[model samples]
Target: MGAHQITIVDMDIVETSNLHRQALYTEDDALNMVPKVHAIKEHIARINHHVDVQTYYQEITSNNIEDILDEVKPDIVIDGMDHFKIRYLINEVCHKHQIPWVYGAAVGNKGTVYGIDFKGPCLKCLLKQMPSSGESCAINGVLPTIITQVASYEVAEVLRYLSGEGFSKKLITIDTWHIDFKAMNVDILKNHACEICANQHYSLLETKHQQHIESLCGRTYLFRYQSSIFEHAHHLPGEIVKSTSFAKLIKDDDYEITLFKDGRMNVYGIEDDEEAFKLYHSYLKALK
Candidate 1:
């Protein structure tokens, strides 16, 4: 908690649905549609003005993750994402950079926390392959209590790693609804043949594995292309709903677009990939 500097990265804005589980955001934030990174920077300033806060209103993709980590040179990295694709990327990059990291996840009153010191087993070592899609908070619902508990556990591990106390080398599993908590040694899970950690092969870093377009929850789509929206600001065809230093929200009859300065666009109210790609290409034409 007393860390002198903190870096936060997120491309999403505050949504009314997030209020139940995410404590840092307020109803006003959702109403104003504040980017999560900006909201966090503001809140953290109120909590501790002495702490230097660096915010990046961008998503972590394979194309930019290594550069982001290289620029920050963080002593440790913490995982707060919902999907495993990004986690795998983080795991591989952090492993390559020799930075320790803590992996955490919470859904439906159950959560898991594990730490990797790079000297021992890593996430790939424990999870040999990408897991099958499972129930998410969007579908199954999560308790606010579980989010807080899991986050507390993650911060504690960060502190432990930063203080040179070392890791417990145990995977913590918690089910708060049943008041069950278990920690089992995970050092035995290390595989000598693991590609990322043991053999130093980072597959997730490859661009071919990274999709530029993705279907998000709630009929939303994200199109990630690295271009400066400011260069095409004059040609946007929608009413500017909201404009910020790092991104702009534009809305038309058919779609709502939040285009970042780095060209990551999130389109809301789209249900089909064909329509989504059509709209994306039309915008690209406009930009040209």
Candidate 2:
């Protein structure tokens, strides 16, 4: 298969914290303001320039979803997003479109990888019995080894499916801390009368989840908005404040926001690169 035929949809950025477990990143890689998808694409290109990679620097919310999936037209989608909202979005979009996708999650020293081929149970099918999302790395703090291990398994599954190696329709969980791995059959449960699966309902993807914000002393980068336009405002350089505790508001030539200790802030300046760049640095000072 040609490299250009595969496109990974990841909208996150490389953070200083992710270096501890992410194997393919360097200090300079994290320093660059590139989105995680682009960063991974660039890294892959170094190994094989023939691979066609793409990215969307915006969060997967109710808005801008069609544009993302439409632009990618990927043969299969991979899970690189941390946001549960986005994960569910991918699940529903894939199920609705009948485009199979893989599910994976890692945190601390454990993770899981599974595939959702058309004949197998989907993420929503599993969620009918389990919780909405698996344990997130943000809350548990992922180990570099754990992410690498889980990601490698995920990639292996991808290769298997694409190379006609054929993947098992089972859920695979790995616990690196204990060095345990297990896979169980789940194909039959897909049609076992589940709300999200049997009934073909996808409440998680259909709903809109809000993000919270917090203010810190000596800095300001929080903004409040009740408009849908603000959803796509990601490309415009702005912090999304989900909390209402921040009472103080500030603005400058091209940025406006408030800051809190919880590390949440908003930016509203000139909706362009120059202003976004300046505000990002200014916010970084507060982040420090």
Candidate 3:
């Protein structure tokens, strides 16, 4: 926990629903609509004044990841992302840069943690392709205890790596509800024919493979278009709920949308994929 500097990136706003699991935030933070990164930075400053916490209040995408990583120049990266697409992007970039990273995920009482040293099996080596069905905590429901448990293991791995103690080379899996724990040796799972780790291919870094739409927690969908929302605010067909220099929130009968300055849009109250895409295209047309 004694880190010199830390850089965090996120585009999400604090919500009351997440307060049970996300302990860093409070009801006041949610009421004020504080960005996750900002709230984390403020909280970290309160706890550890000496830790230089740099915050980027934006979503990580193929376009901006390289620049952000170059500036931060972190010794190691940690995975706190909700989606696999972004994790794959991080895997590509970190492996390319020869930076060590720890991966952790939790959902519905089950969690997994792994450390990637770049000298061994990367994430892509373990999972050859993206899982066909994406399971989220929003859909399955995650226990608060699992979150802390996974985080504790993740931080331990980080400490071990930083101290030059080396990784376990085993993927740790746990189910807190059932009191089940298992560690699978992943040394045999390393694919010698892996595209990213073995062949030095970074397919996720390509623009064509960039993830534009992602389904997030609580029946929310995030669309990352390449057009600034501020430019087309006047044309949007919705009641302006809130408008700020960084983002604009609009609400209609069907959906609530928050558009950021960087072109990322969070659409709430929609579950169907077709409906989400239809709304995104409508907004895209309006922006154009």
Query: On residues 64-117, what C-alpha lDDT tens digit does candidate 1 reach at each position?
Result: 898898899999999898778788889999999999999998888899999887
Regions of model 3 farther than 4 Å from truth: 136-138, 208-212, 231-234, 285-288
Q: Please give the CA lDDT of all the candidate structures.
A: 0.83, 0.60, 0.85
Task: Output the number of the lDDT-best candidate.
Answer: 3
Models, CA RMSD each: 2.9, 9.7, 2.1
- Model 1 regions more than 4 Å off: 132-137, 208-210, 229-239, 251-255, 272-275, 282-288
Instruction: Report the C-alpha lDDT of model 2 over 55-120, residue by residue, as the tens digit.
Output: 554446555565677787777777875545567777777876677777888767888888777556
TM-score pick, better of 1 and 2: 1
TM-score of each: 0.85, 0.68, 0.91
By lDDT, rank the candidates, best first: 3, 1, 2
Name the TM-score of candidate 3.
Answer: 0.91
Give the per-residue lDDT digits (tens) of candidate 3, residues 1-288.
589999999987887888999999999887767888988989999998999999998778888999999999999999997788889989999999999999998889999999998888999988887753346656678898998999989999899989889777889999999999999998888899999999998977876455567777767888888755577877777888877666778888888888877788888898788988888888888878
